[model samples]
Target chain A: MTFVTITFFLFLAVAFLCYFVMPKQHRWLVLLAFSIAFYLFAGWEKFLFVLASALIAYLVGRKGTKSSLVFGIVSIVLLLFYAKAGNSILAAFQMKESIIVPLGISYYSFSIIGYMLDVYYKKIECEKNFFAFLLYMIYFPQILEGPIPRYKKLAPQLMEGHEFSYERFCFGAQRALWGYFKKLVIADRIALYTGEVFSNYKDYSGIYFFVAVLLSSLQLYTDFSGCMDIALGVSQCFGITLDENFRRPFFSKNAAEFWRRWHITLGTWFKDYVYMHLAIHPKLLKLSKLAKDKVGKRFGKSLITIIPLAVVWLLTGLWHGTGADYILWGCYWGIIIILSTVFAKEWKQVNQFLKIDGNSKGFSRFQMIRTFFVFSGARLLTAPGDLKVSAYMFRHMFSLWSFREFFTKGALVGILSVWDVVIVIIGTLILWKVDLLQEQGVEIRKKIGQYPIPLRWVFYYGLFFATLVFGIYGPGYQASDFVYIQF
Target chain B: MEEEILELLSAEFPEVDFTASDELVDDGLLDSLTITGIIATLSMEYDIEIPYEEIIEENFNSIAGLASMVERLQEN
Candidate 1:
């Protein structure tokens, strides 16, 4: 069930009540029961798959010693591959119909694999309690989309004694309300415009298509990060901490920094589990040394680093979907980042040598704005269906056309009002400011809470009321699903 | 030996102070890949094989903890 649905809130309230009312030792059992029930409520067919996977992982993890842990690891990996890569495998089998992916399979599979790997490595001891282990894997708050919880981080909290706290509930509710506002107001509104432009790219030209791409990026960020906020806020009510997944990625100075901020858990997962391992390979090291000696230090670093980055980005693209466009999108990012890194030192030198208004604040601000547009242009490649369509869109975007006609279009104006655009810009700025403050080690919620009751309540009520009045909700509007859920 | 290890970390990540009591893994000071790098380096430099299973946070919780693990491996 969606977080926005009335049924979900009803289920949450009932579960919350039962959980706090239960005796201290039995609280975990209450949570486990609710989690299973919730999963079954969403889809009964998929519940079986989740159970089987969890059981297999737990049993193998418990039985296998460190030396024999490969069996458990392999089993988990194969299951994950089968579930996640089912469509590709089915295509190979010459199946015609679209293969149904089990909901949350990608997320929970990773969590299960991470748990098994941690257990095998003895980073965390194997949980003898089956119920607690099951609860960790199937926790309802995180089951749909995840801040994929690590066993070491979450298991203790599951086992910990609980007492209902008014403060925690208030904080979680406020956060959830804010998340809903982002999803309904900013993201959904922007999606209306982007959806129209992208659906008929051939019709739009010049700045119209370019504007859509820039807006699509914002819509995506708000939609995906909004879901994460809801997930985190819901989990917080249970006193379970899920990882913060996004950090104002739009404000990042470079593509690499953007990856660090966006879908943080997934990026870190790839870095820890894939990229780092390849980087430290004996073959890679030897090649790095050879290149450095034969060519030059600059070329060597570029060659060595760029190869791994390319592979990582290629996998990242493929992981998003089986589409060629996704693959191209991934490579597009890979090229941008690699080139940026390659010329980084030289770029700095050029900046120094030219001294072209280098000291002026206005010049630096202009450069930042230029970089943002450049990044958005590269991201347009991510939206098209194939290379042909992508090229067509690019051609239209650059073609010398009637600028007056584009601005005067009624459909464009109808889809996104002047006030709606203004609201999106303001909302994005506020979100970025909050993220920047947090990055600098400031706790925003804590500071906000510390404000006098009248001021704090006013801010809360204002946010809630604005969401109620301005938020997009109707028969035709599909609650835009979180983008990363496809992965 | 501990001072040498600290020196290596200090050179690698100059942002933080490497200390005897710091919980590298638990406190998020050092990520999993960095730990793997340290393990690989230690294996090569000391002619000691650090088993993957033994690369848990307990062994590398602190400088003293890591030193003790290395000392034990040397004894073996």
Candidate 2:
């Protein structure tokens, strides 16, 4: 029942229809039923983990004590830990593996932890209704891959019944249409090329490996953000506005700015919960002061940024996965961001020394390109799914241009046919142009709305049929799951 | 007190306009980084420890808010 399937759409149609027909106060009941149905379709075992987390939060929220807050958070983190690595630990103990990693445990675990912290800090009144808490915790749209809702904002909206709005429904359907186009047409097409190149890294070199690295980055972007579009769009049809997760990330000019725009919800979650908490802790503050008196003021100030950022990045890496490559990936970004920030004055000085206009459009384009390659470097680390294969790809990446080989060989990557390559390129360009328009603050859907009904329907049906016909779904091209769902 | 603190902060972060808005944090004038910088700066200058609970937007929204927090911390 992934977003890329007809079954999910049928389920979605039923949910959306029932939602509008139910009595105003009873609409949430329909949502709850469908939400449970969606989870049950996935597996009943996964819901037990969600249920336990919800029950812990509900009990701690009702108790409303600091100790319960500690208890709740620790209990939730351990539950998440077991789901992440319990089997491995059990294997080491000569024990049978018996933990079931629930779907979207990473997403909900963070939500519940953040909710508990907010309640203890008196940021929001504790949620009294266990059912409402459960609904927010396991809301179907965001439960799988999340924008990671804040409790105060999403809980009330979940409980409140929304009247049907024609404009909203149109906007949502159009958004989902775009999502399907990206997921089916663009991402899966590129996946056909990248999957083969990455899996058989030994056979490719030079231009092939280089192109694979670049496409893998875009493959992830479209796949994950495509899913976000589906989730947010589906939620919006019911008058719920989930927080956005991507903001034209590839256009960012540096690693720091890139993170600010990419996977934005996850970054904000860490900033609020981990970075801010550590930065303002009295002990770290005291340590910084002592360093100032003992060593130097600049060194002391650097500590404030370095320590928290390192911890956040490490935890961010761990949250992504408990892998050696992911940890190094964390350190990779961490080091770049820390160095750039701590030496921001020096970076500006170097740009000045090189006679580069830091703010000019051309220089900004250069910076965007640099950020892209820097991002591709991080992708190179993780995309291979193994450290040694990544090293082999890196070492043999620059042997020769081999344009003749790439063209004269069996299409691209020995698997992608000519039409597949054409579709990927054309689809990629359309994605780029649309993202560029949105970057410039153009409301594309609104522009389409302003067109006469006949033309608008033409564009809509054109996209719909385009996805149906061109989407990669035949033999050997499976509809890949949204990339972020595994996280 | 607000005047003195504003003068000091302006000297430290000359690029910022402390008087631009009463809702600096709410209005996006102060970000998380700038807020952390302000904490480090005030902690060093006034020799006061700002606790975790005091790291809210209300305290860092404007120089006036910051001055009050600093005064309260300095007294304690």
Candidate 3:
């Protein structure tokens, strides 16, 4: 069940009660049961995929052989590949209908494989208990989408039954409420505009496309990060601390730093497992040496680094989807990062020669704004089904034709009213304020907690009533699913 | 040994006082990119092959840790 629905809250409430009420030793068992129930609630047919994955990982982790590790890793990758790409393969064979790609397959597959690999490398001990491993694989909060927790990080917390603490519960509840506010008030409202323009780009051009596309970046950030907040918040109520996924990504000064801040778990996963491994692999070392001799040092190092980076980005793209546009978007980012790395020294030198104070606050702001636009522009490739449509929209954006139509009330009020626009602006400003506070290392939740009871109650109830009133929910509007869930 | 490691770190990241903090990795002093650059330079300068398994926080958290890690690797 999605987080927005009443059914999910009901499920969480029941699960929470069962967890606390059960005998201490059996609390973990209760979680396992609830996780299974949550999975089954999504679909009974997909239950087998999760179970099989857990079983394979557990068995292979126990074996801990070179061949077994290879087999286990390969099996998981193949399973993920087939689930993701199976339909396209069947279409080539002239099949009438394609199979459904199971939910959480991409996410759970990575978590499981990471566990087995850790076992293989002796980073963590093998999980001997099948049930514990299964619970780790299918924890309901992270199952839909993930910050992609490692076994070492998540498994022990699941086993350590937590005593109910009022402080923890309040923090988690407030966090979840914040998530709901962002998802409903900000993300969903903007989705009405972005969803319209992306689907039917031909109907409008110039500023309409510009506004929708730019706002889409904000919509995506709030939606995905909002889901993360809810997931992490729910886990926190259970006294589990999942690794954080975002860290004020918009404040990053460059593309490299932006990626490091955004989706931190996934980036670290690829870094630890894929990029770093290949960077130091024997074959790559030999290649780097040969390239160093054949070409200049800078060129050679770039050549070696570029290959693994390209692989990571390509897989990152495919992980999003098998679509050509996704692949193009991946390469676009890969190129940007690679260019930055290769010319980093020269770029610094050029800035210094030009007497630019790269460390100054003004320069930092300029960099942030530049990075934001570049990131938004790259998102255009992801918004449209066809790359040509993105190109057309971009062309119209630059053409300045019919630009006067942009500021007119007629265009802006088509999807949402002026009041709706005002709400969105205010909501965005709040989000920005919160992120800025976090970037400056302010403990906002703790600060809120320090307030007197009356003020605290006022703060909490104010948010609750505001969400109830202003949230984009009603009989006509279906709650849009979190964007990252598809991945 | 600490001084040698400090010299290496200073050459790589001139902005940070590497010796001031023992928790270089724990603090925000050394990022992943800087860590990778240090590893590459150490590998080349010392003629030591630091494998992926050795690239852990414990081995690179401070000048002393880094020096000790390099000495152990060199001996091996």
Candidate 4:
């Protein structure tokens, strides 16, 4: 069951109640039961896949041998590849649909592989209990669209069940309410416009495509980060802290910084597992020396960045999807990052030549806006889910750019209703303001908690009621699934 | 060792001030790419292999950390 549904809320309530009621040592048992039930609630058909994958991981980790490590990594990677790319490969062979991909296969598979690698590398002692490892692989809060947890970081917390605290609950509830506001009030509302414009771009003008790309970018950020918020908030209520997946990504001044902030867990995963390893690999290091001696110091130094980043970006793209559009999107980001790193000094020199203080607040703001548009350009490539439409949008994206029409009833007539536009605009402003404050190191939830009881209750219940009242939930309106769940 | 390594790294990466911050890795002075470059330079110059376990932040945060790590690895 999706987090947005009433049934899931009921499930969470039951889980929450049982967790606090149970003894501390047995609380993990409660969590395990709830996690399994949550998975089964989604469907029993894919249950075996998760179980078997967990078993494989357990076996590999228990063995902790070189061969088993290879086996573990290969099997997990191949399973992920089959699940992600099976449909495309089947289509190529003119076969019908063949694979029933398990829930959170992409996420759990990576977690398990990371576990196996850690085991072989002797980073942490392998968990002696199979059930504990299984629980780590299938934690209910993180199973769907994870800030994918690391074993060393998350497993010990899972085993050591925490006593219930009123503070954690309040903090979690407030954060979750904010997440609901982002998803239901902002993202879903904007989806009405982006959904239509992307699906039927031919019906609208060039300005519409541009608007849709920007909106879809917001839709994705809200929907994905909204899910992360719910995941982390729910986990916190149970006295566990998951990693933060987003960090005001829109304010990033460059592609590298943006990736560092956005989907932070995924970026760290690639860096730790893939990029760092490749950079330190003997062969590549030798190649770097060769290039330095033969070509130049700069070129050799850049080789470290170029080679590992190329592989990391390609794999990153494939992880997102096996589609050509995703490949293009991945390459689009990869090239920008690689070039920026390779020519950072040259760019600085050029900036100096142009007499622009790159560190100035105005210039930083300009860079942030530039990064947003660059992100929106990548959105244009894959948001339509087809490269042809993306190409067409690119060709005519600036055709009928009339600000008067855009600002007036032109946007209101069918594209976006007055209410829809208002909610999204207000939501965007609130999101921006909150992010700005947080960027300046304000702990918003803590600040709210410091208020007197009456005022605190007002802030808490005000948000709760706002989400309940303004959230787009009525007959004829279906809440969109958290966007990253499909990945 | 600190002065020599600082000179070496400064000469290698003219963009960064090696002695500006002790928390180089934590303060974002040394990104992953730069860290790898430092590892390469250290490995090639010192003729010692730095294991993956040695890649922690404490070892890369400052020149003293690097010099100590290199000394320990060499003694090993």
Q: lDDT values of the candidates?
A: 0.75, 0.88, 0.85, 0.89
**Quality of candidate 2 docking, DockQ:** 0.56
- lDDT by residue (B14-73, candidate 2, tens digit) is 778999999998998887777887888898788888876787889988888999999999
Best by DockQ: 4
Docking class of 4: medium
TM-score of chain A of 2: 0.97
lDDT of 4: 0.89
Q: Which regions of candidate 4 are displaced past 4 Å?
A: A402-410, B1-3, B15-23, B26-28, B71-76
Residues A369-418, candidate 3, lDDT per residue (tens digit)? 99898889888988766788888888887555475666564346677777
- The 10-residue segment of model 2 chain A with minimum total lDDT is A408-417
Backbone clash numbers for all candidates listed: 0, 0, 0, 0
Residues forming the 10-long window of minimal summed lDDT in candidate 3 chain A = A403-412
| Colliding residue pairs in candidate 4 | none
Clashing pairs in 3: none
lDDT tens per residue, model 1, A25-118:
8888888998898888767877878888888879867975754466765766676666667777778899976655667877787787778777
lDDT of 3: 0.85
Model 4: per-residue lDDT, tens digit, B1-76?
8888888989888888878899999999998888988998988788778878789889999999999999999999
Top-down TM-score ranking:
2, 4, 3, 1
Local lDDT at A191 for model 1: 84
lDDT of 2 by residue, A72-113 (tens): 999999988887777768887989857788888899899989
